[model samples]
Target: MILGTVLGLIIFGGIGEFSKSQKANSLGQVKYLIGVSYPNLNGPWQLQMNKEIKNEIARHDDTRVIFTDAAQNDEQQVQDIHSLMSYGIDLLIVSVDNASTLTPVISEVYKKIPVIVLGRGVKGYDYTLYIGSDNQLNGNMAAKEAIRLLGNKRGQIIEVEGNKESLQAEERSKGFRETIQRESKHSIIETINGNWLKDRAEDELKNLLKSGVKPDLIYAHNDAMALGAYQALKQLKIEGIKIIGTDGLNEESGGLRLVKQGIIDATYITPTGGTSAVQYAIDILHKVPGLPKKIILRNHEVTKSNVDSYLTEGDNSSIPFIKKKERKIKLGFAQVGSESEWRLANTDSIISAAKEAGVELILKNADYSQKKQMDIIRDFIKQKVDVIAFSPKTEDGWEEVLMEAKNAGIPIILSDREINVEDQTMWTSFIGSDFVEEGRRAGKWLVSDSKLTTTPLHIIEIEGTANSAPAVDRKQGFNEIIQQNSKFQLLQSYSGDFTLDQGKKWMKQALKTYGTEIDVVYAHNDDMALGAIKAIEDYGLKPGVDIKIISIDATIKAFNSLKLGKMNFTVECNPLLGPQLMKAVKDLENGIEIPQKIITAEETFDQKQSKKEFSRRAY
Candidate 1:
């Protein structure tokens, strides 16, 4: 038998001898085939798992293992499994595509080779061990965190569920629903299938928003889906909605970093599946019995308080703020110029922040001109900057510039205003305020305050630039609230063009025509309100005393005015976007794809609150 084994080794190489030794030694070192099913290889979890599986295969010197990626197809995965069995593989490891459809294939494979299911499991399978995190536990943990964060508030939740067909998805949804059901106080009013894609989630969320579903909390099965939900919330301008998700992969930073940055409230940890699967296969190969049929790894909840410990080495602050050792990267910026003081501050902050962060910035002022911005972008392409950052002056007229940037192999970071660019593949990520939420907060506040009043209040609105995104959003948000109130009415509205001069001129004319009938002034920005205040003073009407003033963009001037009782409420629009921009650039350089949009955290301030923080104010 030994001689025969040696001869087999000589004839068919080491693989043949390994097979012979398996039969002789009674170790049962059967040839095993592994099949991986994934939606995309671009995500962090898939990439990590692929690397781990490959490493495990290298370590298994005595057994032959065949690997295949199903690439997110149920039929393709079944065919791949059939092909593997045909190659004489003794065992099979499968991460299923569709739990239900793959049941038949798993049953078929089990007749030939013991099938071990990893990450996700199929029904009617009892052939092999299962190793993966408890997804149901993940859902429960997410719900606990959501309830803890919400405290006493009872509101509707929007569930961003994973792919409807996957068992993991079903299990997670089941867990979440069970937990919410147990609570009895809170309810999941609607659940949208995200299909485990960010873009898909965003679309579904946007549709729900347009249909007027007011969600107080959003729970996504995965971090990417959560990010998509965040984008939709921002675009629709919904405010005060808590967002949570799962998955804690290190490479993509997962939802942990998002929570730290206030983009998400929380995320649950889902262990990577590859390493566990490989270990299970090896245990079976060695004839190790008494192995637990099912291994469910515990889930961990990650929140803002404990996220810093999980920050990646590159993101660690111990490293100098900017990597001074590397070649200086030239960055181009196309900005929305002087739309508001906050806009100006945002531009200045990026320029200063990039420098502080050790990047050389080549600044270009679009001056709120889309044509000029396009020209500047083309010039930046000619200059071959490493990366480009721009705040689109308008939603349209950006595809050409974005295409040109993409052709140049330059990654683009969108700041503030979002573009109507159809090919989302053009930009790396967006970092800015939740414009719609800002509007919604303004609206909610207006409604709450107006509810206390007995008499009807006539309001004149000072709108932002006609074409600007914030202008359109702020108007929509204000009207969404005011229209619902019977005691509040908008007497007149005019575009201030986001300029003090335009605001002053427009207000003066409205004052001349309407006289003292206007009870309040709502400006899209603080600069415009300051101008409106001037117009009010010129007309001999006490500014805040006679006509209550409310505006967005709590610039220093605006806050100071609020403190002095000249402005009633100034919603904060912080222009400090430098940190997020630099982080995105670094993440891209490290080969990580950024999410579609990142909405900055914001708040509202009245005269009373402004007085407390006036001394510590930065902008």
Candidate 2:
């Protein structure tokens, strides 16, 4: 198949050659080659996406897209990506085939160039950006539609699934099953594998019906499969079964048209994000600042009654517009606490940025109390603030409060820290540094320094606040890198609560217990590392010389300590998120879709580099 595709490319005068000729036609002009990988082009849904992408790119003379169809083969998709790379494509856009298998390959590609993942997301934060729909919500919508179709009657459901390994398939199945179990008097009696193809869905459903089992309702993961299931019912002379599907494409054979023709009852319009993906790809290639990590397009339900309105395409005549009220946008912000220099700098940046943006700011210091932060958020909701932003002290226990905020129609932006919540839609967006990457940088520095000697180095760790996002993610990231080398021994770890006192106390206890066995000390923040330095001095040992110190948060004090030969290395967790946060607040007020996760730019510093970069330290 690969050879055939290559030969076909040659027969068609080769897109790469065409691009080169185009580039040559205009001297000194820059042209970007974008590679688009699709799982298959067998269905209207995928074809529509390809058409939309091509149309959007046609508007840009400087960009050319080379598309590849994997024909629903996972290995073929990986090979196609390599082939595209061999052609020297500038960027890649992939609609993942199998997330489990494709994540590693995509991540490897991301190491070299920008990759835009569409439709389905892979395992990790390796890609440049993800543009896709909320498949789980589509599943929820499908379940609700199924319930409405039953309308006070209990029914058995037959679910026609797509590729099992696909993230979209898994999430859709999970959302549908969980919702049915929780809210409706319906049970999914049997699940048939469709593999996201019409013929396979028909064959599978026919086999299931041949086994003398029947269902009152059919829910397919996509429209093609839904249509196949409907055909199976027609062939088997089965009637009165309500059919629901996803991907409400408006093509002649799409879900919208199918619903209009009474072939399927309802469908959730899962936007392909093709046009948006192209736009974002251009922006990314241009190095646009403040772009979102993930753009989640909205999905709406389409049925026979509303299918005509959707078929009209771009008609906003029936939609009502509300006039905006001119007033200062009220922003309620809650700071975790001033436990360290970094925390103080972070708080000051937000406060100052809010003021500069002409936003009415109601700022509160949680003082390391999650309860206090929740109280402040509740108060913000009560005051009917336009926007609420807070840095969570810990990763859990914000679900109830956030749900309340969501119920009150208030948009929440998470600042600096993240939370562990099931309903992610409770928060609009998260703007913070990548904590895991910071930990990985610290671990990487330690690994690189360890090359100087072969002896096993025993390390002591002073962690930040227990169960906090930074502490947990940093530990995980550090461990991920250190596990690669067996010579690094982690002696012990202690929580510092991001406080200098706790850091000093923990370091003193570790020194007293382990004495000189500790070869290196890894602190989660600059304050803790400073405290560890004090404890090392009290222990009558050199800090940078005897026990090399590694920490996060490159405060001026840490830089000074590095200059004074007290701290060895400090990974920077940039705290200046003021501009980004204020911009997000204003954007949210203007009803813009914010990216799911916005990562702040950061870097690392060592003892020598610290002297040169010290003057540039803002936090």
Candidate 3:
């Protein structure tokens, strides 16, 4: 890895150089010695992180930093951590040597000094805080960019992975494979363990070429391995293959330069999060509250288009402050119970996004009860939080509580479901799906399908909760579309209560009445459709064929059903609206006008095509 070559020099040059760099600070009485340990001194990521740490310490006159390089040895890293504490260091910063064994040592160290772990995270322990980029997002974005470049064509991908023990290796690998699996035209022919090193990567690529396995692209975990892969390809007289990698290190030999020279096609700028780590460390030293237990610094993309601009940019300068001037914004949310797969996934998105944004979220589950949701919202108003958000179970009964919120001058964001409110000024915005459009899309797909057209169709509708906006709007939209078709017959329509059991029971009765006469089943959402599929199977009828199944809400359960050829189609009702909600909150706080309703994007999915994206499904 280029990162390795850049940073490795620091270790071989000797640790004395570290002391010389901090010589000026030695004159002052060291109030604190923040012990820092890195697993690998050879990588640029480690080098940059440590440099930022020292720079941050340079600003704090009362604090000095002590450093150690484990040289990728887990045992040495563990031992170094102990000795640093023995020297009476006030705290420890560890980028672990090994994610597994080193966790025990880290856990022990935390009992003494507050631990701020970076990069290679250990499992089964709770340290003070973890600081790093979301490696999974890195992998995911790389895969998507590669797919875009290789559009509508078959390609062989040679994946070069980081060290197996590293968390980035697991997350990046998973993200890449998950998306690649869904893109049928592309395949990972083989994965070479690069160990985040350049020489190893070169050797691996050379061997692959010698074996006559042609690769269309090379994907490395870091810029060094990517450079190695590019060199090996050049030596073999192979050209025109796109090479993708991570760690957008902006140096002569790093990703930015390589990308500018057209050596690497693209790279994800995985921030070292060192500056944030130092800032967080300072916060702990000052006993600041409201700092998150974890901090995931954002990652960015680098390509040929703006490589020069990126290269020109300097380091993020610090305006050091003992305490941040802006207090943490508290957000309150009333989540609907995990009644279905869609609801569960929505909750996950909100929680993860809030944590990442460093917003203090006061969350409550209403368990799909109107009374409970009202109480939750009322409590949020009482708490006087800056912003309040919720996904209501029913459209009714929110008017009173929403009015109370408006009276207190707190902005409200109605998530997923918009309620029956008289005053439009009561809520700031609605961030969710356009249910009516989702319904129309589903109906249109059924109407346009070659198999279902020109036939007298017996359609059985599985309605959701009686008064839910999704249920009512979806039914209305379907009715509006199918009303003109005389051949389309409503065989038997009833409420399934949006429950799997109820759907099964209703379908069982429908089966007894219609038998194979039921040609189509339009479920309000995926859960009911999944339930009806079970009921269809129990009656010895093959779903997606003898009786076509169509539903809304493109969730994991729905995807699995579609993949198995058990469900015919599902109109996507996307639930991952958390990031947008956070942005809206920030915009509102800045006195910017947000739209009254922020309608989310939706898509259509069929069994054959939806199979391609099942691996990438978050829910």
Candidate 4:
């Protein structure tokens, strides 16, 4: 098998050359030593994950990987990581056996080197990047398939679960139970732990059957467990109970083959993301642009109808549903008003990209009003546009209008912001910068820059529009870092509405109230930072010298200010998302699924780097 061949290479330490340069040849290509930590390699799923990571790393010549297995023991995993650290590995790729027990150690290690988490993630955003399939969605898909298999009649289900310590198992079961209860006439009557083993599932099923409880359907957390239940049914001369499972592996003895042989009724394709982990590790090491904090792999359901195509095509979920004649995709984009240079650049990028991609763009500006944005979306729905994209004014109140778009069969893509909705599947994907990470980068710059003194530093913040995703997330991310250090003191924050006028007004008030007491000014965007600079200069104080200024949204204006030594630091929040948005729209039109979140590449700049980087700024 491919996995077996890869395993042989991994064991023998026979690294190969790159099959294809994954990215542009990075400068200063250092031979990096990489460490991989695995929970266990006991099952086909685990083995496949290991194989993919090893195979991907083998393609790159400038990297060497050393792996350690924890044998499913959390303590042993901790020890394995410590050993890997002792080797001074440049990066760490880990799949935790248990999140709760391993998070502290992983968090500690992240402070030193980049950590890429796979399968299960740690407690907080302590790692560099995470690549995994959504486990909750896995259960949701299984429950959906169960409802379809059971049809109209109410059905009783027996659920065979994985290890109790596994967060994936808990989330999968929770999603399955909650979805079945809320969306359909189905009940999970009996829940038993199979410990993620086929034999265990078989033994547990025999006991459940002997107890004289008959279920209409059996749902297992994995394909092995589902196949185990099938074995129990065969031994007891029982039939007619539908089976659903997760991890639709394509091997001969895997879920795809089993379903093809009429063993399991349905299975969800839960990707391990092992190859993605390695590929993204290289990207992170190379400091690639436009990398997201999280990459949620797409998952789909496989049944008798599409299993053959799924197996044959490998990645295409369903055969492109009856091909339509080539036509321009009409994309309705409801933008947050051109409040600043960043917003205008974002709008221009979208328009230009739409033209380049041949998409018929129906654009509307919300003018900084959530109500107006909702009206625009309603209008788009009425117009029956092919796709609707919007940068939400606020995170709330979007669920209802988004539901309207979803019900209208038009996919919604969130641009430059996010929304608070009960069902996240309401939107197809979110494409933007990680506002939280941008804030974190700003904070990190302030703490590390040698110009800032060790004494207590007083900070005044000029914020964006209230309740907006960027404002809220940026505050949380910045505060998370600054709160750790006692030297930084945040005096007061002013709400600026992300406008230069409001920023200047608030800065004037702050200058009158606090006077020369403020040592730093943090603005959410470039216009606000410029406004603060004007306020400081008007108050007879040099902007970047007297008051260290930091801001987000690294626009050309911000870059120029950085070069002029007016703004000390500016975090880049790229507004040029037109290319990515158009690509996603075209992919959806072609019946291809995109990731749940698509983050733009961003960076930070100081005065020294501004001149060199200024010429390359797209926004």
Worst 10 residues of 1 by lDDT: 316-325
lDDT of 3 by residue, 9-98 (tens): 243222333332343344654465577878877877677787777677777766666677777777877777776776577788888745
Q: For candidate 2, lDDT tens digit of each residue in 1-619?
A: 4653464355323535455335422333337878888888888888888888978987776776778888888999999999888878899999985999899999999999999999887976788888787787779878878988987878999999999989999999988998898998888999999998989999999999999987999999999999999999999999998999999888877898899999999988787888889998998899996566666666768887788888986322222111244989888998888788998898888888888999889999998888999999999989988888999999988889988888877778888898888566688778887788889889989998888888899999899989999999999999998989899999999999888888899999999899999999999999999998999999999999999999999999999999999999998887888888888777766655555666775667898899899887776
Worst 10 residues of 2 by lDDT: 314-323
TM, every model? 0.52, 0.72, 0.54, 0.67
Q: How big is the positional error of residue 222 in model 1, measured in Å on the Cα after superposition?
A: 11
- Which lDDT values do the candidates have, in the order given? 0.74, 0.85, 0.79, 0.84
**Where does candidate 3 stray beyond 4 Å?**
1-28, 314-619
Q: Write the per-residue lDDT of candidate 4 for residues 1-619, one digit (tens) a residue.
A: 2242244335634446322222213532436777888877776777789889878976887776778877677888888888778757789998885788889999999999999988876776788888777788789878888998899998999999987777788889988998899999788899999877889999999998999999999999999899899999999989999999888899966899988999998988888889888888998888875567777776778889889887887755222221343777899999989999999999999999999999999999999888999999999999888899999999998878877877777788899999888576688888898788888888888889734677888999999999999999999889987988999999999999898888899999999999999988989998998998998899999999999999999899888888889889999888888988998888888877777777665667899989999998877
Highest TM-score among the candidates is held by which one? 2
Weakest ten-residue segment in model 3 by summed lDDT? 316-325
Sequence-dependent TM-score of model 4: 0.67
Q: Regarding lDDT, does 1 or 2 come out ahead? A: 2
The residue ranges of model 1 lying beyond 4 angstroms of the native Cα positions read 1-326
> What C-alpha RMSD separates each model from the true structure?
22.3, 6.1, 16.7, 7.7
**Residue 163 C-alpha lDDT in model 1:** 71
